[model samples]
Target: MISHMRRLLSLSTAMVMASTAIAAAEPSAELIAAAKAEGTLTTIALPHDWCGYGGVIEGFKAKYGLTINELNPDAGSGDEIEAIKANKDNKGDQAPDVIDVGLSFGPSAKADGLIQPYKVSTWDSIPDTAKDAEGYWYGDYYGVMAFEVNKDLVKESPKDWADLLKPEFANMVALAGDPRTANQAISGVFAAGLSGAGGDVAKSGEAGLAFFKELNAKGNFVPVIGKSAPLAQGTTPIILRWDYNALSDRDTLAGNPPVDVVIPETGVVAGVYVQAISAYAPHPNAAKLWMEYLYSDEGQLGWLKGYCHPIRFNDLAKNGKIPQDLLDKLPPAAAYEKAVFPTLEQQEAYKEVITKGWDTVVGANVQ
Candidate 1:
């Protein structure tokens, strides 16, 4: 009787341990339930039209019945960081649950402890280069630099970086934002460096900065923010911005002045944007679910629809999941295939060079 009682007790303890292991390993259903209970998610800097967040967000809301409060639609990568840092102590809807920022910002945010590590179910599908090993941040989509022009205002569109330095583009060239704080402008300078350096641009190389300095000296670099308004009014006839932004402008202003987006013949550089959860997210489970949805096939396709290349495009293509019609609408894959992505360390170093040297090397500002 004593031996039987001991055996029963051992079995009971083993069962309890096994149950605990199962509970720990399988939390998806519980997470989903908890997320639904939360019922609300606050986000920052996601423009409805930019990168198809308009559709993506609506879809997410409908799918999960969650309320999404999108704050600061026109904010930049820096703004997103500020939002997270400012709201670290806020445990309400005012705090941002997730962030999407430039690749350079990812490492900085992770290092600053502003973001947390959480790998989704589809983590393995993301390329090793596009995500942190521990999942602090992961690349969502990327766009190449392009020249957006108002064809009606400028009869001649610049085809390459060197073309912008020509006499005709004087007082007409503009960047989306300041390089010191904007990834788009930094990428423009990087692309110019590649073109000026004979297709071998380094992250911290001076060739790009030199080209911009010349542009400033020539009075071709306008100190103005590049946006659809400036482009439409021809205040900044030529704007250096992301391909998606330029293309979106083309469609948005179809009958107006007719914007022309040109991929520079030389120095084509791609910039990746990463997504991460705020370290102090109020709805942690919902945030994780958001990450899961963003990485899933539906979310990736939503990005493609918005004209950005999803990080998991290759994986989706291999599985024959991408529709051919949708594939056809994308910019030639070869261009992006040949594109270069700076490593996190390289991006950080390059950002330091640009930010520190922008005032000294390229003082030109865009109004």
Candidate 2:
């Protein structure tokens, strides 16, 4: 009787260990089967080079054998919003499963009720500041606003907000575009405002206006649009651009026109490239799967390889996935230690301040 009891106990222990191993080994068979049934995913994206989305498409296709159809819009965010509004009814054929756009447009997209809320399981891994509370959208990558200077143009590069105001940089500095038109340009203006460029503009409309007026007087202003490469190639010596865009230019112009990027001593405003799912998406399940994959450890590391800061900084740091050579290319993490978001109050204030300021300062001065 004792021998028989020992055999029964040992067999039960082996059965429990086998069950635990199976649970740890793979995803549920149900999920894999559902993904196979989804068939395809369609995406609409801003005008990023193939390098930006290529890896993601390849990864998704290899894992699920699903087809990915991508559409690149020629017009900006306004055009994308207009397209969605026009096609709200017959969505599957007309609308994309997912869309990517600039940061400022994220709130507007949410307000229009064009986006759906679906937080990935990895949501907690992303910082709260980088994502919407209700999961309407989340930022995948971001660039810090900085000065891209030509080494040959000025004896020394402008190091801070105050340096641009000097007489020496007169007619030598250029901005991306009118703040009313370009999201990046607006970020630059606000960053300057936050750093005391226009006195009290951090809290008042008059401050932003006064700063632009001073810039106009110093002859330190030029309005350039859509072409940062030519500007860095020496058409204009000093231009405002995001760090990655500037780095791309610097890499392209290795010997000629030699450009260098610097985060202004005052502060850096981080502008993001955000992604969201369409409210009327045909493949909602697949879209959710894509977002989940994007935030996973594998997908987040891809962003670091592509030179865009991954949204989950802590995860990347913990994994040691960010290489030393790449770390050398980026601004010190301290530069982003105190980053601030533009509050709803600031966005409202900007509509009036930036528009009116342009009329008074840039419009009056343009020949």
Candidate 3:
């Protein structure tokens, strides 16, 4: 559910957000030809609406005239790596050529020898801290956690994490994913605790567990996988999701049920997702080409339209490459100002705490 890195200088990283330089390398003609020759590019665990991947995929296919062999739109980061491992020797349609996963997964995947390395043409545009020095993985886009509320069902949305504990919210609140596995849900737990812990990243993991335990005890927590469908149908009126997902849900619903995406006043945590070519990619050239397209300005803006802050956003904005309309589509710049970006180490540390303790501490099994 996340890539996740970089502190905000409003739009993520004070250094990155202030940079005005723009460097882009063109894909070699031979590489483009080779990728076209491959004819198809396999991708796993990319939901069309998440991070505006729907438009990005369509744009890629339309631009390259190559078929995208998409697999497991609902699969998690773990499933993506397993796909590569399972198909290491297979060269058929079931094989995946690339993956977009959580930031933590990138290094672990590289360590496991499950991913290959290829620097995109716009590689220099991404922040150094957000990418692998060896080019094993690179941050693609990121967003913070938010409350996606069905306005048709709930009159007043929770303004902060504590507000969700109100008696009125009973059986209404839900997590977008199973905290035991989904990065989005795990981050949600961490964010909840951050406000309670006075912004202590180290203590958020445990504090989040306590917060959820309390919410569950109050019968305000719904043990259900909160998705757009569930939310629209009122099964889960308030779902914790990445801002991009929540915004996309609002646009998709089109006011039929109305949606309100709220960035809590406290405990703002951002997560970055990274991309990499598979180690055993059958269509390696195509995978590299896809990377090039993803890092391109066109590709980055596609994500912006979907409400994700592309990893290269700082450079894009400083150079005036980002359209004003696109910028306007985002939630207010002020809402993002105080976001706390947990380092990869902190994310890993908290991830272990939450994933390992969610059951025993919170005791609500999200389906």
Candidate 4:
């Protein structure tokens, strides 16, 4: 009797799991209606070589027969934010339909009341930690900070956070830029902190600050801003950069000095590029449609082709959509399986830590 009951319970649990997934997969009728009424979408994005935003835009236009009125790619998140603030009042004519900004800027945008809430029908597809409860923004693609070492410079690559501090690597390491100025660099700092070097902004910024100070003292730190390609090409042998960028660079230079990307054994810091609809969007309908499409399996696949991790993890797993060959290209998916998602609390705490710490440790003597 006991064995029979246990088997039945297990079967019931499986059925419940299947039911929940089916319900979650269903799209929202209300959003579909709204999208049909609106005929176009306009978006703003920070410039990135691997985001695959162009492919996403083209696909949406082709599918919906809706014009993507604008795709404004600014130099950085700060520039995109400035454009939104400058046109907040003109909801219908001047404001953008959607905006893609770095993870750090998402909270600031929400606090400033520049973002509007509209949960895409595919909301359940996104990881809960990656989206706001009230639906202000949602992460679409995330990149982890990893070591990009030039094989020619060092016969043996650095495999962990501790390896970066070795005497031999002195004056040879370069970070993207200061955390306050660049999201990529800030992510590297967070990864360092997570790796046990000390990143608790609330308790103490000492660990993170000291880590940089030590690097500075050893002359291992090279401050490069804006362009990372030149640094990767050979001017600097080892660089702290996102895996996608590193891999994309390596793919581009197959015949040249190869760049090896490694996720440090200690831990990795993941930075997410998120999407939000402008509070005063001029093309609200088109924007809603774009959001819906981007969260779909088709959109997620586009991201995979561009070498970005899809936001809809479950779909990717169920459909077996991610190519096995590309899967081999990435760090074990398990490495990122339980990856940390930056919270609003963490972002707020680190903002002060990064800003002050950057001046004292990095910005004070930049070339």
Candidate with best lDDT: 3
> lDDT values of the candidates?
0.79, 0.63, 0.87, 0.66
- Model 3 C-alpha lDDT versus the unseen true structure: 0.87
lDDT of candidate 2 at residue 63, scale 0 to 100: 77
lDDT of 2 by residue, 1-367 (tens): 2222122122232222222222223333565566568877877643343113456667777877877866553334444566667667855655678877666677788998998998776665555656789999987776677888888877699987668889988876766554654566666777776676433345534554556578877778765542445565555688776676676666657846777778887745666667788888878777877787777666766665555676654545544545677667665666554455555456557645765577755563321
TM-scores of the models, in the given order? 0.88, 0.74, 0.93, 0.78
Question: Candidate 3, clashing residue pairs?
Answer: 3-272, 3-273, 4-271, 4-272, 4-273, 7-13
> Candidate 4: global Cα-lDDT?
0.66
CA shift of 219, model 4, Å: 2.5
Better candidate number, 2 or 3, judged by lDDT: 3
Which candidate leads the pack in TM-score?
3
Point out where model 4 deviates above 4 Å: 1-40, 46-48, 65-74, 90-96, 198-205, 226-228, 319-326, 334-339, 364-367
Off by over 4 Å in 1: 1-27, 203-205, 365-367
Model 2 regions lying over 4 Å from their true place: 1-45, 49-79, 86-96, 102-104, 197-201, 204-206, 226-228, 282-286, 319-321, 355-357, 364-367
Of the pair 1 and 2, which is ahead by TM-score? 1
**What does the lDDT read for residue 326 in candidate 4?**
53
Order of candidates by lDDT, top first? 3, 1, 4, 2
lDDT of 1 at 362: 86
